[model samples]
Target: MMRFVFSLMIAVALSPNAAIAQDKPSKAKSWNLTGQVKARFDAKVVDMLCEVSGGAACADKCGGGTQQLGVVRKSDGRLFPVSKNGQPIFSGAMADLLPYCNKDVEVDGLLAGEGDIKIYQVQLIREQGTKKWNKTSGFTKAWRKQFPDAGKKGPWFRNDPRIAKQLAADGWLGLGKEADVAYAKDEVE
Candidate 1:
């Protein structure tokens, strides 16, 4: 009986779920400000501004992936602005959706936000008639291609030389060197 009780306590202590529970709370619980919901639907990619203005040639005027892209759901014609992809901070889904401009696609991801300010975070996508799904990792891949010299680890913004140079010139807070010094002095005192 004593041996059985000791083994059970050891098993409980070494359990993966118990270890994870003690390490840290889930970030998803705090970051879910917009009530994110998993969504998988078929939609036609469109330029949000042009679609709103009734421009038939909207996709043609995406300005080389500079313009914002969105999707119009096939079932109800509900428009969803795709603001993010499966990448980390400062990333967008424009590149992932750019290739399928004006074409029908099946998107799987989370729909978040409220009322007129909703956004879609595209996790996976595929052509409407295709069986294979592709992960929405275009932004990070493009960034790696564009900045081959940047380090492989950490967020792209932190490793970007251009951003670092800009931050150095404008201070960490982007309020000029004088302000940064003033703020630091105030905080220290």
Candidate 2:
């Protein structure tokens, strides 16, 4: 019984680290593009500045933004998502990566390994005199104004439309998406 207890203790000690490593986020790398890259997709940065500048939608006319995506262009300047191989599998949270689409990008993310991500460093290529920081924020800022519940069961990240769009893209349709995935998992665990 003592030997079995010792083995169980060791397993418990090592398990957390293993679990952490698996859920770790991956990263990307940045490079200046003089020539054409084979794989370029429409993407953006989901940072707060972006939300203030671009809002929830694509920001087409009046909501013009600084964020742009890296496009794989030919000598004639025609663009494509397919690299030297096949089509690029667009990944990452859209709320986190889509606002910068159609703008020049410099990514610094990981290709493989446990916590891999393909993200942007110099994500935007603005045209001329644009201010660096956004003053008009706090729109999507989470507050307990709506749900004054006693439980820590208060909501989070609801007003932001980018996250909503991302959830929809990820096949999570409505309120039940967050409930079904996160809360349900905790119950099972």
**What TM-score does structure 2 among the candidates reach?**
0.21
Q: Cα lDDT for residue 111, model 1? A: 68
Give the 10-residue window scoring lowest on summed lDDT in candidate 2.
Answer: 80-89
Tens digits of per-residue lDDT for model 2 on 1-189?
A: 999999999998765221221112222222332321222222222333334444564444223323332232222232222111111222222322233444443332212213222222222222214434221122122223333442343234553345556877663535656665886688799
Tens-place lDDT per residue, model 1, 124-167, is 88897898888888987788888999987888988998998998
The TM-score measured for candidate 1 stands at 0.72
Global lDDT of each model?
0.76, 0.33
The lowest-lDDT stretch of 10 consecutive residues in candidate 1 is 18-27
Clashes of each: 0, 19
Clashing pairs for model 1 are none
